[model samples]
Target: MKNYLFPHIFQPIGWIMFVLSLITGIAIYSSIPVFGAGIAETLAIDSAIIGIALGALFIVCSKERVEDEMTKSIRLASLLNSIYAYVALLVGCTILINGVKFLVFAVFNLVLFPIIFVCNFRLEMHRYNKMCEDEEQD
Candidate 1:
């Protein structure tokens, strides 16, 4: 039963989201007068996909170890990327006493988070599952 449930519950959703984010992030980071420079189709697509994804995640996480572990693990890296960029810019602006654009920060993470996620997610998930297995053995 657990074996049967595993595939239904887990299939690299985090890793998939991470890839989608990278694609969208590149689009946003370009900042090239998209739909006339404020009317953002990019955000619309991204939010819609993310919303669907998050709902799916909750459903899976409610039942499966792998899904829950993968989501939480990838999020740790992604959130840190978000927070790091946000704080770094805020501090840099404060130090320079220069105004900072919110869009800069937005685009920065919109690009970086996925890159970080893709780089770290697979390894993290493997490690986490192994830890779970080890604990179960003990």
Candidate 2:
């Protein structure tokens, strides 16, 4: 199968960046003064955005351990499931939240897509490996 992914190293780096970005974003948001705006303000916003984008991209694009047909199939399934779950979440949030709150949640859902896909993919991979192990033991 044609495996479309980055080198494995990128995955860990991506995780690091993801965490750092969260911390940086929090710091930026907290440090922004009510009345003051300057270079730090702009830098904080830019850095946080760049960090999150790069991190999510790296993690999503990183390679699996064995890029075989089975892995590809699992990845595809996980992606589809994630999409379904995201849509469900969006719908639920839309029904529960109103106005700006719903808009914020929608934005959150957009950013959460990659993270959800990665989580689902890893969960499916783990289940697949467990099944294989059980079969081998049997």
Q: Can you give the TM-score per candidate against the true fold?
A: 0.38, 0.75
Q: Which ten residues in a row have the lowest lDDT in candidate 1?
A: 1-10
Tell me how many clashing residue pairs each candidate has: 0, 0
Across residues 1-138, which tens digit of lDDT does each residue of candidate 1 receive?
142233543446644554555455455557544434444775644663464445334333333443454566465674566467656756775565534665565435434433443345445656777897999999
Tens digits of per-residue lDDT for model 2 on 1-138? Answer: 465689989989998987787677666656646324688677766677677778877876787666677887897898899899988887887789998877756645645777687789878899999999999999
Error of 2 at 53 (Å): 3.6
Q: What does the lDDT read for residue 1 in candidate 1? A: 15
Model 1 TM-score (2 dp) = 0.38
Misplaced by over 4 Å in model 2 are: 23-42
Q: Which residue pairs come into collision in candidate 2?
A: none
Task: Assess the local accuracy of residue 120 in candidate 2 as a C-alpha lDDT between 0 and 100.
Answer: 90
Worst 10 residues of 2 by lDDT: 28-37
